[model samples]
Target: MKERWVVVIGGGAAGMAAAVSAAEQARYLGVDCHITVIEKTHQVGSKIRISGGGKCNVTHVGTSAELLEKGFLRAAEQRFLRSALYAFSNNELRALLQQQGVATTEREDGKVFPVAGEASVVAEAFRTLLQRLKINCELHAPVQAIKVHGQQFHLITLHGDIVADAVIVATGGVSYRHTGTTGDGLRLARALGHTVVEPSAALSSIMVQPHSLVALAGAALRGVAAVARAGKLRAERQGDILFTHRGFSGPAMLSLSRDVANMQRSQREAVHLAADLYPQQLHDELEALLLQHSKKQGGQLVRKFLQVSPIGMLLLKSETMPYGTIPNAMVPLLMRQAALDDEVTFATLSREHRHQLVVTLKQFQLGTVHNVSLDAGEVSAGGVALSEVNPKSMESRLVPNLYFCGEVLDYVGEIGGYNLQAAFSTGWMAGKSAVNKLLTAL
Candidate 1:
């Protein structure tokens, strides 16, 4: 067999996996090959080092395949991601790491991290594996330009020009530019006859207006939020809402960031988030409950109705009843209206006032958020269009011997280890496909 050189760009999760997989495939086929990983940064897998707050969420712990797929919301259809995921599922990924002496543990929500609870360990394991395989690992080698002539790829880097029989571009997306993902893949794909979607922020925080939310900056509400655009509810997600100093963050807001980013780009419109602070009951049900509580209590203020902690009840729990998690902003707004006479109490509220108060309780306006930070997101949402790349192989349909995987691709999964899983699966597929295609051609 001929000696083929496979070059992988970026050196993040996807590039590292691709390089390793290609080397494994070459060794298995008894084919002579040189696989090199080109990283622009000082350290490869820098993002992995910082992921999951330095814990490195390697993959989702959905032991079952169905639950694992659900983590990939608003992404390429399962039809597209099916083969890669099934071939290298969550358990398989964990087992592969285990073989390398890196054990992982699952969290309450199914996010899997190293048992050691440090991302650097996972990166080190990969580094040790590459060293064992004698795969070339180059750092501080930024890709400046790329071109293809005949069947070979010419990759111009800060160091110099390096030609390869095949190239896997896994340069990631625009998020975390400090980690070296500066939308290099998108630009490179565009330059190579691929359609590049406009990149934006995903898993990011939004900037909200209205003084009420601004006041309760540290408040966190455990409930559901309905995203409304043009006065119509577009989507709804249930999770913990984190109130940030800038605006809104946490799982729910970050999950809806894709739609919010689209709205910002397409219509330049601000969307309203109708937060159900007490999502356990419907609006009418909550209204009736509040009215019933008001009637039962004789001249008692809404606040003094139950003996509960001041801030925790208002912000955290909604378990036993609507006693807590009422959102600090709504406490004053509804109380000021529900109060009657000099003594402001729930019992003093008339039927009409109680009904209005209940309505507000069911749907507390967290206010309108206009923008989500692009650079602050966990992942960037746009990249090389899927149609231009073969999902099964992670190879570019338009550019021969050129491939893409990970955040460089158009599909961006939600938080909670889905993105990492996709990176591994796609890189696995790309590595095998690239090696097989080149060897077969020879």
Candidate 2:
């Protein structure tokens, strides 16, 4: 019998998982299979080392496969991740980590991280597992190009040419370029006659045109519903938002960035973001509350109440009240109709203007964003098309014995552990499936 050689490119979360899982499948089947992982960087798990601020978010605590699938943004992504997610579930990954002496903690929002609270610790565990499995690892050996010749794959690299019976391209998307994820997997896949989804920025910060926004650059809002309008797409997310020097960022911004970016790239749509600081309160309810607060805090300066938060310092700077003068509290600035002058107050203002204040608070416009920089994205969305790969096995439908896993695929998940979980799941399936198919044929 021929000794099976499986080559896995990239050694991030997916590549390592694939190598180990492939070896495990071989062992379970009692097949003599050799696995090799070729990493471009000096070390494996480069991305893993930096994830969750060095404390590796292992995966979401969602035990159900359906819930895991729902975390993905696109319908195709959600559907494609189904089989792989079920094959090696979050629970199974958690159990494997626990058995390896790593404890985990689940946050209230379901993000799971190592109890050791160190991403290095998680990376160490993977390295140890690879060693135990005897998987050959080649670091600092980047694959320059990949060519499929009949039943074998020839990977020309900086080190040397590596020929293997099976190959898994686990190189992640072009994000975190320092981590060596420079779309190598996409290039390799495209060379093998696969359709590559045009890559775009995801989880990136938006650049707002309004210059006055810089004043509230550090102001942050929590549990706010951020609704983004781009082209025909209207995406919404609820979380924390940080007003950046350029525009908006943080969880809420990142969550909708991919969708917004995609729309921006595809269609020349005017991208606008609006934040509702209080999602619990309705427009009418907010109006009443604003009036009540205004009446109570009437004696104080206008900038000293919730109205200030609604306007932030960003909107205040736009007003024509001197160059730096703040609206008077007793003046009831929100209740002013004509030209917001020094005369208007709650006592003399019309009811219509008072209601408009509620509208202002409920729809705090972030203004039109000019661009979502691809380089700024945390994860690059869109890679190898989902149609080109088998979701069940993570195998390339066009090329026999060829597999792909991780962000190289045309999928991007919302922030949390969803992306990592998908990578691990698909890699595990691809590894197991590659070896299983080989054994069956042999």
Candidate 3:
């Protein structure tokens, strides 16, 4: 009998998992199966090396289908993810890592990290697993074209032509192009009759214009709530917000970016983002405190009252106030109103420093984003439409024996470990299902 073969394109987390699962399944079936992982980059898991700022948040501890489902953009896509995520939850992946000599730790936010806290370690874990399974990995082999004939798929690569009974496209999205995720997989999938969602940067930082917030760059506000509004719909997230030289980043901004991207593309209108610097406090309580402080610091410049809020202090500037003096009585009223609604008058931000404060807080708004740079993003918002693929097997509905996993699909998740976990689960499902189908056919 001829040896069965499964080809996995792109050796990221998804491709690696798919190849391994298929190989393992074939082995159990007493069939000699050749598993080939073709990687465009010189090394597999190149994106893994830089993920989580090199910590490589491998997966999230929130294994509940509901929590994981919240991370995806589409309802059907979220439903499609249930089977795979439940099949291979965070605990299962952790155990797999431990078995491969990679110890992991969970952060307070439920994100799991390798003890080494280096993405390289996680990459090595996958590499070691593939090595042990004797999976054939052809690195630096970019697939230029994919041609389907009958039940087989032919990959025209930079090296040469390669054929397989089953093919899995896990080439990932356009984000972090330096990592080799340059949308090749989406192009290939499109050629094979799959609809490719025009990709946009997700889980990325935003760039705002004409602002001196650069002075406050690197300041981080925890439990900050960001709300993006597009017409009647609104999406919000409460997390840590980090000020960057270009614009805003950290979990809060990344979460909001998804909605910002969608609203920009769909509505053709500029999206508005409002941030609540203090989400935990009630508006009335905050107002009362501000009022009390105003009485205590009566006659003091309004800027002096802003010392109460962490975010307020960062926006204060000396030039905005001539004598740097403000009416103390106005402090409580402004603070209370600002807390209730992010929209505040310029005087409320800093009475003494009214001009700068108003510009910084009340009027501080960026355009609805012309585009998000993919090179700096953590993931892409869109990809091959989910309807064209089978959730059970991660196989293409139009092309038999063709499968896709990872960022290649129109599934994207927020910051944390949800995206990586999705990739692993989907890849595992695709591989196992393909193997099982092959066996049953034989």
Error (Å) of candidate 2 at residue 412 is: 0.9
Candidate 2, overall lDDT?
0.80
The candidate maximizing TM-score is 1
Q: Per-residue lDDT tens digits of candidate 1, residues 1-442?
A: 5799999998888888898899999999989989999999998888989987899988886643563467766445455677778867889888889999999998887789999999998888888888989999889999988988888989999889999999999999999899999988788888888899899988888786664556667877665554546334366666777878778887888888877877767764567776655555566666666666666765666654423422212322245643244554545654554443335577567777667656655556767766788898989888888888887798899988899988898777777888888888888888888999998988
Model 2 steric clash pairs: 54-119
The residue ranges of model 1 lying beyond 4 angstroms of the native Cα positions read: 67-69, 226-228, 231-233, 306-324, 327-330, 333-343
lDDT of 2 by residue, 2-38 (tens): 8999999999989988998999999988889999999
Supply candidate 1's per-residue lDDT for 439: 86
lDDT sort, best first: 2, 1, 3
Model 3 lowest lDDT segment of ten: 321-330
Show where candidate 3 strays beyond 4 Å.
66-70, 230-233, 280-302, 310-371
Please rank every candidate by TM-score, starting with the best: 1, 2, 3
Worst 10 residues of 2 by lDDT: 321-330
Overall lDDT per candidate, in order of appearance: 0.78, 0.80, 0.77
